[model samples]
Target: MSRVLIVDDAAFMRMMIKDILEKNGFEVVGEASNGFKAVEIYKNEKPDVVTMDITMPDMDGIEAVKAIREFDSNAKIIMCSAMGQQTMVMDAIRAGAKDFIVKPFQAERVLEAIRKAIG
Candidate 1:
């Protein structure tokens, strides 16, 4: 199973993603409620993939992606955005995210993105 780190400011969102990933046989290695913690946990855990929320507190997903990529250029990141955040998604892509998933969490899309990213 691929190890994954989930990053979001909302506890419920993290729980939802954890549930989805675990049910589908992915191992959830760590979770973070802010971008700062996301970066720190990422460095420590070194998960195979990351699902990052865009509008997080203290650094944001884009910045976290850049930081993680700096630490490991091959880092595979997937940005999780709400509908209508096209520009921010573009920014995230530019920052080195491998792919993106739009929320409110669709299991299939999430899995697809993760599979494609880790490939």
Candidate 2:
């Protein structure tokens, strides 16, 4: 089972992800509301995967991904992006996110990205 860190500004989104990951046999190790906390949690939890939101209040996911990658070159990340965020998604990938899932999430697609990211 993989330990995962979930970073989203929305409380509901975090809960949804935690529920989905838990039901799918992945551990939700930590949750963060913004990119700054995301990086802090990443360091503390050292989860196997991180599901990061692109448009966050502080720092944003792209910068957070880069910061995480700086500390851990092989850190596995899956970006959670809204529709029509192709440019940000691409930036996230370039910043070292392994894959991305578009919202509102489908269980299958989210799982696929998770599997692909950690596999």
Q: lDDT per prediction? A: 0.94, 0.94
Instruction: Give candidate 2 misplaced runs (Cα > 4 Å).
Output: none
| All candidates: TM-score | 0.98, 0.98
Error of 2 at 24 (Å): 1.1
Location of the lowest summed lDDT over 10 successive residues in candidate 2: 110-119
The pairs that clash in candidate 2 are none
**lDDT of model 2, residue 108:** 93
lDDT of 1 by residue, 23-98 (tens): 9999999999988899899999999999999998878999999999999999999999999999999999999998
Q: Give the TM-score of candidate 2.
A: 0.98
Writing each residue's lDDT as its tens digit, candidate 2 over 12-83 gives 999999999999999999999999999999999899999999999868999999999999999999999999
